[model samples]
Target: MGAVRVVLVGGHESADGADLAPVVQQLPEAAVSTPGRSLLSQVRAALAGSDAPVVVLPMTWGRDPVMIAETARTLRWVAGGDAHGRVALSEPFGTTDHLIALLRTAATRTATRWPGSGLVVSAPRASPFDDAELHRVAHLVRVHGAGLEIGVACVGEPADLTLAVDRVRALRPGHVAVVPAGFATACPEADALADVDFVGPLMTTSAVLRVVRERTAGALHDLGHGHDGIAAGLDADHGHGYAHSHGPDGDHTHTHGDHAHAHAPHAPHPDPHATSHASALG
Candidate 1:
């Protein structure tokens, strides 16, 4: 038997520290780590005390295949050991059914007032794989948002937030929910448009915390079961959420976020040095 280490990896942040207090306090060995120098520093700190197997859980919604590949390369370059092979990365925070509900909850709460409303999921940028996940989640939003005039839109790269906002505005919906796709980070106080209402970040919700634990716990469980390849396979079929009748404990049947929209197959593995380092389970 060997020591096990857990690192909750997150995106670039406004504050030097992570707002993931709920995540770090849950597990002692579990600490917050990001990609690049911050992650290298965290790795060095963890290793200075003991040599243990590491598991990384990405704290993000919408799996970005590009980011994971970049972090793997960064680990290889810094640690100069079995960083890639030994270190295990869990699925992204976004792919779970819990998050689909959280977004629905937040967006639903804010959209209650308006007769005709739009649902907008915002992120840093758009990629082929990320876009696919965003669209899949959008379908779930539409299902849950039965009464409202729900519309799906992407923010950042390939498409601008304004463009999506405009699409919603064109319909002249009573209001629009600018829901952020990421877990937690710095967000503006108010939306620019008078009719647009910000749904805020999901980091504060218990749902986000539950998903974080699931990723870490799932990794530890698999490590106990023995590798059987890599835990990265979670990203393969999980892009569109799952239909389980229970949580990780299998206690209660969860049928809230289920839908029938099929997503594209997982993107192929790319070169070691890739551009988009954002990854999900891989």
Candidate 2:
């Protein structure tokens, strides 16, 4: 029996990959890296040198199109343009039951002191699009801490740490735990939790990895393969039921002191590079 070769892929600079490291390390044999144009070449070289089955693990914050395309390309190359059995691409970590378990554990750890009442703040990366994992954290907190108040927030938005603090202050909770629902600590959202009074370990890659390893171990045993069923179960268990509000439109006005501020009109694009890059992730 040969060891399975798993390659964990993500945005290396992002916090998510760092959080998934411990999980990847627990595999019998694995390699992890950020996706790039030459990522396929690198994987090919690595696979050529090893005699184990390859599993590509995508540890992304959410379902990103660019990363998905890159993974598809890598799979095609690995399978000689037909991805039948040569390589398998595991689902992204954010949508896994393992992640849900981690969220629950984080909530438990953070709310241990309060026991009956506490705040679980899920601080995700700064983006207009709402991540489903953010809501999952809230759901997990609600489940683990029945009487706890759970709030979801995003960095650089109205639903930010400040709002979370305000909510906590108003409720006068015994403790507050701000979980960074992101991959790495480099992001501002993850850093914002530094001032928060958390009861347990901050949700980091190390914590997430532990959950993933345990979940994968169980999935591997029940389904004959750990990479496939884990994702399906996660998606099936957690339906897309969360709602997010968009910021005010350009017509909205803001008053500051004696001055009023209005949003600027749309600007025309002059460079193809800018447009191309903007659409690349879509």
Candidate 3:
């Protein structure tokens, strides 16, 4: 059997291949790609003249419509239509549940070390669904796992850092413990906040790599069992032609043209959270 090719897809401003070198080195046939022309070229190369199986893993913590939709389009472009059965688009590397778990772990550590410090979960601004998901994750962590008062803030939401810190300060714990979710580094202005103790990004941890491996293995298994996986759903979701222009801050805008199918980015069933990919394309 031919070796299964693996493509690790990251967001536009995501850390370059250097940060993903460990993952690539471990996988025998793996390469890293970002959206737009970079991913288009990579997909073309990966699918050229071979029927060998390929697996795509989105290296994100939660729902990323831009990356997922673009991957679908690129695959369709390369295949001259829908991607074949041999190709699979796995779920993102992590999810909101994963973020909740990570934050819960960090909350425990922070509570033990700081004792009375309140916890603030900071995340980068993303799509509405993702932002809502982060809020939900924070709620879960606060209600079930965290002993300390926990608040949530987004890096570039309607409020600024000062206001966010002030909100956390209102909680009136001994100190404010800030933890970054969905990303590795705290906001650049996090240091400016008074009496804030930053906890972690958790990007370089073994747990992250483990999640990547698990997603890849699951995709490969689905391919082996005749499941086309999320790629088919993505292809179906974007039956119309569209182009993307990325902003300096990694924000993206879509120029959709000549729509032929329903625009349902999240309508793809058997979501990554599901146990089996067999019915996702149906």
Candidate 4:
């Protein structure tokens, strides 16, 4: 059997590319692209020369339309314009539940700095994936950091940083944690907001990196052409089983392996007669 050739398709950001490179380097045949090149072409070339199954790993924050499109195109090519393939597309790194857990941990670690109240601010221009992640983090804040006030905001959205600050300030929070839900500082929105007192990179935390590496390893196992192995590995690692079924429109539905618990961010006030109206934004 031949070694699988994995092609990691990352963004135009050098830092993300750099972070992803070392993760995939130990593979038998792996390559990364320079910032600002034709990612599709690079992936195609990598595939053309490989006798082993090709795996395309998208090293992005999950918002770049270009990366999404390129990944789709590569999947199509590998699938032979059919529904299956010897080569396959792994779920983008950001979408995994493991990644979500990591984000929650990162948020919690940063929130510790703020003693009284905490806020999780998502970059306004973050990708849909990032937004979804922020929602997950918000839920975590409510569950794990009870008694802390929580608020959510985006840079360009209706609820920008100022809006988030206003909400937090209204509660007279002692500390504020700004979580940049982005993989790189390439986006001006992320860079501008990261200057806040409590700020941290999206995937810089050790937990997040561990999940990324595990997911990458899973991708490689899948590309080796063993469906059962892939599912089993993911299930065992994440403690959540995977299931796929076709809907009416021939669309695929994905079921995650684990269940998440939802909890309120603040505890009930001591005075039973007192009215509490604090809202935890998800």
Instruction: Give RMSD to native, each candidate.
Output: 11.9, 13.7, 8.7, 12.1
lDDT of 4 at 209: 44
lDDT by candidate, in order shown: 0.55, 0.49, 0.64, 0.49
In candidate 1, what are the lDDT values of residues 127-195, reduced to their tens digit? 555666667666777687545445555544434766777676677645676776665443352255566
lDDT of 4 by residue, 163-196 (tens): 6866776786455656555553333443354334
Candidate maximizing TM-score: 3
TM-scores across all candidates? Answer: 0.61, 0.55, 0.69, 0.54
Q: What TM-score number comes out for model 2?
A: 0.55
**Residue pairs with clashing backbones, model 2:** 15-183, 15-184, 16-183, 16-184, 19-205
Best by lDDT: 3
Worst 10 residues of 2 by lDDT: 273-282
| Higher-lDDT candidate of 3 and 4 | 3
Residue pairs in clash, model 3: none
> In candidate 2, what are the lDDT values of residues 89-181, reduced to their tens digit?
554544434344555666666557556455645544433333544565466557755466677655556347667766765676444556555
